[model samples]
Target: MRSGTDVAYDDVNELIATATRLMQKDAAPDTLTPDDVRKIGEELDIPARYVDQALEALARRREEQAREAQVQERHARLRRVRLRRSAWVGAAVLGLLAVSGLVVRNGLTSTLSDVARQRAQVRNVVERRESLRARQDTLTPGLSRDAELSGADNRVAIEQRRYDERAADYNASAASFPTGWVVRLTGLPHVLPLSSEVSTW
Candidate 1:
């Protein structure tokens, strides 16, 4: 078995130079002579049998180098494919994030719109209460102690005033209740209209 030390021992550059000279000489138009091989073997200080082995080893090495270069080129192509696939994956992730962000923004906008509608409805109820109270005030007459003592109708008027005031408070609460949330959260009847019948004190 060739250890790392044995593998590194051969001077590849010198061997290649020697092989090139031998090939050029043999390939001349003239026929190879035994003297040529003898001279090369003596000059390189190698046996004739070892020289033949070296030539075969050189051919095998050249073939291995070609195969290694092909493998390296294939690895480079695979790396490029992987890089392109990664870029596409990154883009897909970014697109998904953008879509998710838009969805969240739309949800927030809808929530804000719902809140605004509820606020507007509550404000409308408050304004209506104010108007109703103003009207009720005109109907209620202020009574001094002398007027209170003077008539039974005045006592009836005072009792009627209390009823209207209580009814107005309920009407205000019913009108201002948030229709969407309240209907789902609690089951309740609508406020009935006020009565115009005179009260008997």
Candidate 2:
């Protein structure tokens, strides 16, 4: 029977007053009844039907809230699964890198060792040649021209030349191979050792 605007303003005032009283008491929504809504509507000059509509709207809002909470729970579970998978993948990658590093380190150490051994053999050959030359010089005046020491000196020189050739070949092969490929391919256990290790000639 009242004007729409007057009814609306009165309804708003009544709703505000009820809300303030409920807040002071910390009243739960379950305690709110249709009779309480109807009483507020009557005081506001509002129709009883509108009060029922407001209660239905509140119920729909509660249902929407429940659906949103369920969605958030599913999203949190999916995030946890993705994080665990990423952690495992990261660990596997780190392990592979560590194993590769060890293989490369061992290969370099072995190659350097072989080179050291070859150098030592070359030094031995040189020392033997020098010793033979000294003996030949000491015996030149006392022994005949066709002395056994002269023949021994020739054999020592030949041995020295053979060692020299091997050293030269080793140096050449090392030069031909690039450092990157050497590390990558030679890191494997089955791959043959450097060229110098297998051949004497």
Candidate 3:
């Protein structure tokens, strides 16, 4: 809103100050046409050629600003697309890695379980042989034959052989490539191919 056009000002400076403050809030930000530029130049004693050069420079600046905005928009669109695809691809890769990790973990667990079982069998056979030998030793060899003791010795040997084979397999797996990493991560027990300690009865 304007103070009435008919209002009197104390001086030109006062009028200019009021107009400046009003323009700060009330300007429409419209661009000047060629006619407006010429009229302004004529009033301000500016040359027509200078006005033409100013218009040409303004046009070039506007073109540059428009191009910069387009480039920025294109980059933004590319980033959005990459982010969207990365979400899907990342999820799929993670799913595959999870499945693979589980498989390796289960495999190691199963092999170690077998090694533990076979170790128990070997121990049981050795204990049984020792007990039979003790019983046979208590009885005079002349009275009872070596049949039970022989059988116990054979069983102990067979079970020991089986346990050795199972331990060997476990050791091989633990030393293998990706499964080795899995074993390390899962804290799986390490098994040697065979034990050197001997039990004799």
Candidate 4:
């Protein structure tokens, strides 16, 4: 003979097992009528009132589980969106940096090229003046003072002065703020002072 406690325990186990089987069968909560509860109670040999209460409790538990699953799914979707946004932001930042680097590189290259061309012009002028001096030395002293020679000397002097002024202006601009940063970063050489002889001429 089963004691009252054993009988109650058996009834509770039967209720849990039957509820689990119904849930596994995908029983819809709304479809579980009072007749279904009565049938479960008869099968489990438990009272209809207890079965009805258990069915209601099980339905609430299933609803709560469904709500929790939805919440978890929403959180997962939110995390994926955040991760995608982060990736886009990171790519944008890198692209900006790459473009900025290219701009800086191109600017520095152009500036240096201009400076080199200017320096070549200055060298050519200096060489021309040296060639003229050598020719003057080969001539008689009177011929050196001829109108043509004097005019050539004057023109060379004017050209040398103009070159010096231009060079000085360029150096000043490069040494100033903004441009100076580019100059320093590129390691550009500073313009040299004009020869003292050019000033006297």
Candidate 5:
């Protein structure tokens, strides 16, 4: 009679050989039946009880493997969904940033344009005042006392004052929040106050 260890070893060998043959025949392990185990056991001269245990063990292993595969597949699907969601979120954030940059650029351009226009007006007023003074200097000394000339000088002074005030007001507005950022970025200098002296003949 064979020792218990020898019998167990022989049974394990028979099981391995039977499984190998089934694999060579393209039999799926998950599709193995108790009848197939019994047939293998009978052919190998293994006990019926042992054959039943081996069948149960094989079924349990197959079920565990199936469950594991399902869990892995579920994890892979969830990971793909999360990656897609993250990509969408990133794209939305980038779009928002691009829109915000365009809005800021437009605002800065508008502010700078207004500042340039105001400066040009102020320069024109100064040039006109200078021209008037030079014309008065060329007039006859007797004509210098004329009331019409005096009134014209006064009007020019008032207009100069008005232009200066407007320039000051624009500067103040540019120095305020939001618009001030544009001023700093463009390196705009402060607008000087116009001379208070009126041109007289």
Candidate 6:
């Protein structure tokens, strides 16, 4: 017959949930160190081999995530370079056209000003989202995982979605026809240009 240590968990979430329930029943400490973790595993009838396997899986996941981040950063840089080149070339053409009165500078200038305003709005939304995310992280260990944490998470998601929408609106205006070239020329960020345009705070 299988022992209690033979507990089968399909995923990390299941393992955490099982462990948490057991710990709560045992009246374990709120905080736990590495040794505490191992001890708890023993008390919970969790196999040492499973713990090692979980650690290995976690390490591999982190490494994969790091590599993914590097790739995103590289792609973002490449996009910026390509955009810079195009924007500068367009700016030169615009300057010549403006000088010869072929293109009305006032109309384009007004559009660029509007794009800058949209960019400012995106930044404000990003600030609020980040602040909420920080609080969520702080409360992860002991906070009620139900309504309060979910509410905070929902708020963050909403802000992030709002940021994405506003950024898309800005990028659409900035990337269309002559406005994109002008916006970049005026030193405005693309703000989620490509779907994979990764950015860090």
The TM-score leader among the candidates is: 3
Better of 2 and 4 by TM-score: 2
In candidate 5, the residue pairs with backbone N, CA or C atoms under 3 Å apart (3 or more residues apart, or in different chains) clash, namely: none
Kindly indicate the candidate among 1 and 5 with the higher lDDT: 5
Q: Write the per-residue lDDT of candidate 5 for residues 48-116, one digit (tens) a residue.
A: 999888778987999999999999999999999999999999999989766755565465555446545
| Clash number for candidate 2 | 0
Q: Candidates 4 and 5: which is better by TM-score?
A: 5
Which consecutive 10 residues in model 2 have the weakest lDDT in total? 187-196
lDDT score, candidate 4, position 57 = 95
For model 6, how does the per-residue alpha-carbon lDDT over 1-201 read when each residue is reduced to its tens digit?
245656456666887988899988789666656666677789999988887777779779999999999999999999999999999999998788566342433445554465455555545655765676677676656456456556655664565555566556666765676665655566656545422353532
* Candidates ranked, most accurate by lDDT first: 3, 4, 5, 6, 2, 1
Candidates arranged by TM-score, highest first: 3, 5, 2, 4, 1, 6
Candidate 4 residue pairs in backbone clash: none
lDDT of 4 by residue, 1-201 (tens): 346645566588887898899897885565657797789789989988888788889889999999999999999999999999999999999897667655664765665565456556656766676777788777777853476567766766666666566556666766666656656666765544554434332
For model 1, the run of ten residues with the poorest summed lDDT: 192-201
- For model 1, name the residue pairs that clash: none
lDDT of 3 by residue, 8-91 (tens): 566677878888988975775456679799889989999989999998998999999999999999999999999999999999
Q: Judging by lDDT against the true structure, name the best candidate.
A: 3
* lDDT of candidate model 3 versus the reference: 0.81
Candidate 1 off by > 4 Å: 1-39, 141-201
Candidate 1, residue 155: how far the Cα is off, in Å: 32
Model 2, CA-based lDDT: 0.64
Which stretches of model 2 miss by more than 4 angstroms?
1-23, 26-30, 139-201
- Any runs in candidate 4 off by more than 4 Å, and if so which? 1-34, 139-201
What TM-scores do the predictions have?
0.45, 0.51, 0.69, 0.50, 0.53, 0.32
Per residue, candidate 2 scores C-alpha lDDT tens digits across 16-38 of 89889989788546575789889
What is residue 61's positional error in candidate 1, in angstroms?
2.6
